[model samples]
Target: MQRVVEEISLKAWPAFETINHRGWLMRFANGYTKRANSVTVLDEIGLDIEEKITYCESQYRARKQNPIFCLLSFTNPEVLDERLATRGYQLIEPSLVMGITLSERSLNILPIINQETLNDWLVAYHKLKALAEQPSSTHHMILAGIQSEILFVSFKQNEEIVACGIGVLESGCLGIFDLVTSPMQRRRGYATAIIQGLLQWGIDKGAYFSYIQVVKANIPACNLYEKLGYEPIYEYWYRVGSNSGNEK
Candidate 1:
């Protein structure tokens, strides 16, 4: 189950470049989101774990990025995390993969709009969360790189967007991402409305399950998902080298 979710997630949130060394997949995306730029260890337990780590560090260093390793609870060679810690890597962003089985449910979708163009969505999103020119550009690249079916749903009030989220549908699962609500408009049920609508869309498309990745420290987000019937599926965290900055 972990492997399946990880595979779908990689496809849902793609990287600009991916290099598979031995077994680990090293991703790079101009230092955008850590998820897009970190190395992910799947099911391979190749020999020379130390050598592999050095190779990954070199690769990321060449790209001017701090080395980051994303370790899942079920990652192979179980000692990888300990080995990384011994090499001066610090743990960060302990997060959970939450999921729920989709079923029939009444949805109160707010006055939301489905963006037609990437620019349109970005414009509305910028209104909710400020993004500089460079990050805005990189975010656009990441979103445009997704090949699966996507939904850019935004909640509007008085003709202005107050909250927004993205739904990526693939392999009978809906992977939710980029859920953010305007600071002043939060706790107003906009997020709940958007989530209900997204889940309904997934069910309409024959999806059996829906999932989201949230940082453990985000209490409101964790609570929101719980109220929407999502449960913790697995935990993953990043191990950042001494030189790497924890961007995002």
Candidate 2:
């Protein structure tokens, strides 16, 4: 069922798109989509890696102008470090593609946030992005179309907003994104709570399954998803490369 849902959703909108970065090709897509296309990075001196990195940065920056660059990732590509050497774009922490099954666990529906609580939710989101090295924006306008949808955030015992998550209902499934907890707030099962909340919310909306993406090397996250009743269906590689005047 989950596989079928993913296939239909992908076909409808093509969760990810590929871009050329001057001889290097990269995948740039909405992070909420959970699709990592591919990226390939190769080193060349005269072309200047810094220039290429700048161009790539500009591409996303331009995307932000349209309110679409809220979240994105540069995935696994050959010779990434080698190409970034000249650009000084330091590699950030790796991520894993993790998910959960809606059929295997009992979920609880948390209360919705009121206008007063919306500010608090935004703060929590900002903190999570800070920890994850993600870009920041209060693009509530972008979410205007989704006002009827529910956004869930789970707090710790001290109300420190430890774990934050969101779910988008499409067809018969829920796509989860922005699941993060503070480093100091780890090991309190907050992640699990949020997942349960999101799953329950999806089921309430008549969803058939839940899906999310995590870096392959994130052992803790992977284990957590497995414990929550998620199993692997397919794995895709991310490759980034600088553009070399190729149109395709």
Candidate 3:
């Protein structure tokens, strides 16, 4: 299952690159390749492992200007992990890549948002932001960009924002990101409603497919996604490292 997940993750690299907001990239001797924000691998030939580590650390330090850094994978690259540990970096949590076919499921949630309810949407996002490892700036920026191209459907209870989701139209598919519900709002079907609302929006936009990513260890979330017809598409691991010493 792990290997299968890894392969699927590798397959989604292109889509991941297209949706990434940070514009992260990997520098090579010949040129630079766009880096996968949530997951990627270090593949450097000619240079020994140490040299590769040095290069990646340098790149990571340079990219830290954007705030938090993410190194995602499905398996442990011991060589890289050890090098990173020698520095000040620490391994964070693992993430899962879950996906579903739009045609396989039906969407029937009504969107309850309009220009007058924009503040409610922002409040909901802020509430969910507290649950993420990092702040929500990147997500906020992405949402801002997609507003013109996609529908931002949300759900509220008692006039309080509880759940929100976004659907982006790309290459005949709807890529769903930042589907979140507040801790206080769980177990009340708000998440399901939010996803359904987004799916309905996607269908309206002529999208034929949909997909999302979640952490592997988050069993409750995995169950929720599976219950909603999402299947395991891939898995990714996050490794952190710093540039303090050791050249390849």
Candidate 4:
């Protein structure tokens, strides 16, 4: 299940550039998001863990980025996480990979506005998330890199977009990302509406499973996802080197 979800996520939120160093997937996206700019252990075939770490660090340093290692318990070397910590890598953003099985009932939910234009979706996403210009530009590049079927959904109140989310469908699975709601519109069920809408659309398109990645510290979001029947299937966290200036 770890490998399956990780594979789905790699496609659901792709990086602008990916370099496979033996068994590690070194993803880069101009340091926009850690998920897109970290070393992810995808296989156990590679030997010489220290050598691979040195190589990945050099690669990230060449681009002026501090190397970040994203570790999944079952996929990474058992000692890698500890080794990173001893070398001054900070553990951050302990998150859960949650999923729910979709059924015919999800199809009955009403759909929301499906923004067809990538620019339009980007505009809405930036506004809803209040992202700055530089990161927003990098976000655009990352979203543009997605190769699977994607749904850019927006929820509006009185014709004003109050919430937005993205659903990427691949191999019968729907991966949800960047679910955001306007600050002034909190507790109004806008986010809930967006999730339901995305699930509806995904199920209509033949998706039988849906997953989301959320930080453990986000109590509200974790509770909401729990209410929606999403359960934690696995966990992953980023090990950040001391020099990671813009770590997320």
Candidate 5:
């Protein structure tokens, strides 16, 4: 089950390009999400773990990224984990990968939204996340490059956008990303409405399951997702250092 969920995650946020290094997959997407930029090793490899780490570090350096990192889950090889620990890799950004089996729901195909809607979504995300004004180039490239069917759904109050989400449908599953609500408008049903809209699209496509990634410390999101039937299948934390990197 863990392996299956990890595979779904990889498919959901595939890198724009990838490199295979000694059984480890190095995904690069202009540093959009750590998942796309970090190393993922799901299978056992032939090289010594320390040597493999050295190789990955050199590769990321070539790409001008520091603090080489890896996506580590329980399904990853134990020997690799020990090697990273021995080398002083510290974990950060622990996150829960939650999933649910989709059921029927209400939805409209939601016409391909205009750029304004996309703008609103980014604003909400940046505000909630305390990021600077959203940069259109990197973020837009990441969002628009997804090959799976997707929709940008939002909730409006008095003609202003208050909540938004990105729904992706791939291989019988829907992966929800960037679900955000204006801080002032939260505690209303706006977030839930956006989720329902995305799920409905997935149900229409005959998807059997859905998944979302939330920071482990986010209590409100965990509560909401729990209410919606999503459960944490696995927990992963990034091991970060100048010598190594943590989960992305």
Candidate 6:
């Protein structure tokens, strides 16, 4: 059902390297993020399911990275999920893939968008999450590899970046990623403003649909997306490989 836009969605997220093992798709993006470094499109084609799974596992192991299977709700064979569960793979980040038709969306607010603002987003993301002092090189790679039309938006207060987000467009399907606001700026509608700016940017560029992935545990983000008319038509989770899979 969502396959049409899903293909475009997948294309928008260009991985650095991809391998096909008998119709299964595995992507590697320097292990910066899970979605870009996971196995998906587990099609029941030439190889048996177990064989495909084994190949996926071996490939990641050879690369010295843990394998992650993205299990989608509408997956064919219906039993794929069960097979993964039986293999000691733990389910993680049961996330909602919310999307909405963008034809009806409108916002009058302006966004401060350009390549230069990426540093602002990086500062906000690192500070708000309280992550390590040094950032990963793969993050920069992932951001730099975006081939489609994109925009980096940031809002400032008192001359400091308070909120930031990014929008990407591919074949009329716009994807929003890495939307983060300063911890001190929460509940001030800064996040909402960023979302509105992103949406309007996409719409003005001829986008008619938008998609966002939010973890189910994020109540506030889910509520905000719902208010924007984005519904979770389907969900997916990562089948962690018991190794260094990004469980969250």
lDDT of 1 by residue, 1-248 (tens): 87898899999999999999988899999988889999898886567988898889989988888899999887654688888888888899999999998875534443355553677778877777866543378889999999999998888888888888899999998999988899999999998878887888888888888999999999999999999899999899999884453322
Pairs of colliding residues, candidate 3: 25-35, 50-248, 51-248, 73-237, 96-214, 96-215
Question: What order do you get sorting by lDDT, best first?
Answer: 1, 4, 6, 5, 3, 2
Best by TM-score: 4
lDDT string for model 6 (100-124, tens) is 8877545666655434356656666
lDDT digits (tens) for residues 138-217 of candidate 2: 23323333423546465565545667876667776676666788787787787887777777767877777667766777
> On residues 70-169, what C-alpha lDDT tens digit does candidate 5 reach at each position?
6656655566666776777776788898998866654444533222355656665666565676555677677767777877776777777677788888
TM-score: the better of candidates 3 and 5: 5
Off by over 4 Å in 3: 1-24, 27-39, 42-49, 63-89, 104-120, 128-139, 145-148, 243-248
In model 4, pairs of residues that clash are none
Each candidate's clash count: 0, 28, 6, 0, 6, 1
- All models: lDDT? 0.86, 0.52, 0.53, 0.84, 0.73, 0.78
Tens digit of lDDT per residue, candidate 4, span 82-163? 7787777889999999999999565565746556467887788788777666337778888888999988888888899888
Model 6, stretches more than 4 Å misplaced? 42-47, 104-106, 109-115, 243-248
Deviation (Å) of 140 in candidate 4: 1.1
Cand. 3 Cα-lDDT: 0.53
Off by over 4 Å in 5: 44-47, 104-130, 243-248
TM-score, per-candidate, Cα-based = 0.91, 0.56, 0.66, 0.92, 0.84, 0.89
Error of 3 at 111 (Å): 6.4
Q: After superposition, how far is residue 124 of candidate 3 from its true place, in Å?
A: 2.7
